[model samples]
Target chain A: MTVNIISISQITSYLRELLENDVMLSDIWVLGEVSNLKRASSGHYYFTLKDDAAALDVAMWRTYTSRLTHNLQNGDAVLAHGRVSIYEPSGRLQFYVDMLQPAGVGLLHARFEELKQRLAAEGLFDESRKRPLPPLPHRIGIATSAQAAALRDILTVLARRYPLVEVVLSPCLVQGERAPDSISAALYRLYAQDVDLIILARGGGSIEDLWCFNEEIVARTVFASPVPVITGVGHETDTTIVDYVADVRAATPSAAAEQAVPDMAVLAEAVTVLRQQLDEAMSAQLWMHQNALHSATATLQRQNPALWLARSRQQVDDLVQRATRQVRYLTERRQLQLDGLRQQLITLSPYATLHRGYAVVQRTSDGGVVTAPAQVQRGERLRLTLRAGELAAVAAPPAPIEEQHTDD
Target chain B: MTETSTETYETLYTRLQETVAQLEVGNLPLAEALALYEQGVQLAAACQRLLDSAELRVQQLQSDQPDDQ
Candidate 1:
C-alpha cells in the first residue's frame, strides 16, 4: 500500500464523521461527576463530565441551558443525555447535552422538584393567589387538545351538568417538547376572548408525557391568567405545576368541567322553589286584601242612609198600628157604655110603665094633666110615648074614679 | 311577560327572589301587591322558559399561527 499524506483538517473531519455515525454515540446518557463547569456570556454552558477512569468534555447551548431547572456545580454527580461528537477544530470528542438532571433520581422528577421549590418560594402557589370561580359562569374557555380524550370527557360533563353555558375550545398540543408553548398560546387566546372561566385539562399519562404542564412557561401562564383556572391533568395521582398554581384542582378532566359550571338541575330546582314562594306570597296577599274588602263592605252597609231610612220607616209603622188599635178599643168601649146607658134609660122610661098598663092623662082643651081629681081640666090635647098603646081621659073621669073607689 | 331578552338567568332569578320578598313583607297597597305578583309570575315563567329551551353552544378558537415560543 502506498502511504498517503492527510492534512489536520481532513483527519479531524474523518474522526467527526466516524463518531457521529455511531448509533450508540448519536443518542446516549452519561453518568458522571461534574467539574470545571462555566457559563459563558453567550448563555452557553461549558463543563467536563468525568468518571473514576475517564473524562469527557460537554457543551450545552443557550437553548438547552435556558431550560435547566438547576444550575450544574463542580463535583455534582449528574446524568446527562445528548449525542457524542468530535469537535473538528480541536480534534476532541465532546458530548452535546440536551437534558441534564441530578443522578439517582428520575430525570423529570428532579426537574419537577426543582421547579416546584423555586416557584413555591416565589409565592406562585400561595393560597392567597388563588381566585374564586364564578358561581354561574356564562362562558367557559377550554385549553386542551381537540382530539384528546380529555376534551371529550370535559364536554360530556359540561353538557350533562350545564347545557346553558357556552364552551370555547382553544385547542393545543398536550404533550412533547413544544406543548408548553402551545398551551401558553391557547391560554392567551382564551384570555382575549374574555371567558368567564378556564379549564386546563389533559388525559391520563406518564410523567414524561405530562411534562409539558410542569414547564415553567405553562406554570407562569396559568398563574397570570385573569380569570380563575381549573386544572385537571393526567390521573388523580399526577400533580403538575399547573395544578398547584390553578385556582381549583380536579382529579380528572370531567371533574374540571364539573368545577367550572353550576348544575342546571339544581338551578332549575331553585327556580321552581322561588316560583312556589312567589305563589304563596301572592296568595297570602290576596287573601288579606279580600278580608279587608269584606270588613269594609260590612262597615259601609252599617253606615248606609238607605238602611237607616228603612229602620225609621219600620218604627213609624209600628207606632201607627198601636195608635189605630188604641182608638178602635176606646171607641168600642164608649159605644158599649152608651148602649148600657140607653138600656138603663129605656128601663127607667115611662113608656115601660105605659106598656105595663099604666097611662098618663091630659086635658083635651087646656092640655094640663091632672095628678089627682082636684086638678082635672075638661078638653086638653096631649101626646104620649108608650111601649104599646096610650089612652086619654078627662077630669070628670078622674073624679068618678075616686067616688067609685069610696063605694067599693 | 314584558321581560327583555337581554336579561340573564341570574338577573331574572334575582328579580324573582326580590319580588317574592317584597310580597312577603305584606304591607303594600292592594294595587302594588297585585302588580308585584304579576311581575313575579312573569319572571318565574321566563326563568322556566330559559331552563327548558337552553342549549349548550360549543366553539373552537383558531390560533393565528403555530406557537413556537
Candidate 2:
C-alpha cells in the first residue's frame, strides 16, 4: 500500500495561520517556571517557561518589556497568557506574550522586582517623601471588608488597646476582581473624613487573591493619602504592594493596632517615673536654696556688725582711760620741772643775797660803786650799797681807810 | 467617683506644690504646719491613684495584643 506525504512548509504555514487567527489561542494561559531567558538588543525579552517536566519558549516584545516591573531569570514560576507560533527561521515553537502575570510570587516576583526597580529609580519610595505616623491617632478609619478576619482582628485589637479610640469603618472588597476599586474608594472616603489614621487591612491569601492590592490604582491611592495609612494586609511572611506604599506596614492587624496607641501601663509607668524625677529634682533644688540661706545666716551671725561695733566701742573706752592717765602723768612731770625753775629764780633774787649778809658800796652821785679811789671823787660822791637797799655816805677818799686804822 | 477621684489627684498635686513651698517659708504657726502636713499625705495618696491609672495604660501599649498574647 502506497502512503501520501504532505510538504513540511505547508504544514507549518497552516498551523501558524490557525494559531494567529484563533481567539482562544490568542488568549491562552500557561503555568510554568521560566528558564533560558534571552533579551535582544531591541529591548525584547525571550525566555523559556518551564516546570519540572515540560517547557515552552516565551517572548515579550519591547513595549511589554518596557512595561515590565521585575527582572526575569531562569527557573521562575509564572502564568503567561499569549498566542503560540513557530519561529519561521528556527522552526521552534514559541509563545509570543502580550500580557504577562506572575504565577506565584516567584514569577510575578521578578516582574514585581523589575517594576519596583523602575519605580524606585523614579524615587517613588524615596525616604524624603515618606511620612511619619501620628503619635496618637484619634479617629481611626478602617478600610477592609466587613466580613474579613483582618477587620475583626483590627477592631478587636483597637477596642482592647484603646477602648476610647473612635473607629470609623468603611467597608470594601479586600480581594478578587473588584478589590482594587473598592479599596481605592474606601481610602477616598476615609480621607474625606477627619481621621487621624486609616488602616488598610486584609487576611492572608495567595498571590492572585491579593493582586488587587498590587494594582496601580491601589498603590497610587495609598501613596496619595492625606491621612497616614497603615497596611496590615496579611500574615507576617506575606508582603503586598500596598505594604510598600503605606505609611506603616504592620505584621498583622492586631500589631497595627498596637502601633497606633501607646500602652497604658507603660505610659503610666513613664508618667510616674517622670513625676518621681521631678520630685527629686525639685526637692534637691529647694534643699540647695535652703542651704544657701542657712550659710548666709551663719555668716551673718558670726560676723554681725553690731557685735563688732560693741567690741570697737569697748576698745575706744579703754583708749580714752589710757589717754587720760598719760595726760595726768605728763602734767605732773611738767609741774615738777616748773617748781625747780622757781627755786632757781629764788636763788638768783637780791633778797636772797641780803639774807646771805652781803653788802655793796656805791658813790652817792648817781649811786656809783667805789671800786677805786679815782672813782671816789672825795666827798663829792659817796654812797653805801647794801643787799637790801642803798644809803647815802661821804667817801673821804683813800685817807678814810688810814684814819680808821688810827681810831682803832 | 472615678472622675472625681482623678480630679482630686490633680488638685492634690497642685496644692502640694503650693503648700510645700509655703511650709518651707516657715512663717506658718506650729498648728497650721501640722495640719498642712496631714493634707500633704492625702494629696500623696491621690497622686498614687493617678499613677495607678496611668500604669494600666502603659501595660496595654507595651504588651502583646490579647489575641496574639
- Scoring only the A-chain of each prediction against the true A-chain gives TM-scores of 0.53, 0.53
Tell me the chain A TM-score of model 2.
0.53
lDDT per model, in order? 0.87, 0.70
Taken in order, the candidates have interface RMSDs of 2.6, 10.4
True contacts kept of each: 0.74, 0.01
- Tell me the lDDT of candidate 1: 0.87
Measured on C-alpha atoms, candidate 2 has an lDDT of: 0.70
- Could you say which candidate leads in TM-score? 1
Report chain B TM per candidate: 0.80, 0.59
Which pairs clash in the backbone of model 1?
A363-A380, A364-A379, A364-A380, A364-A381, A365-A379, A365-A380
Task: Encode model 2's per-residue lDDT on A1-408: one tens digit a residue.
Answer: 888888888788877887788888776767887778888999998998887787778888999878766776677667676788887666678899876655664456555665666666766566677677765555678887776688778777766655545577777777778778877887787787777888888888887787787777888898888988888877898887778788788988878888876554564454455445445544555566678789999999989989999999999999999999999999999999999999999999866876788666765657665567787666675556576676777666466877889999
Error of 1 at A388 (Å): 60
Candidate 1 residue-wise lDDT, A117-167, digit = tens: 999999999999889999988789999998888999999998888877788
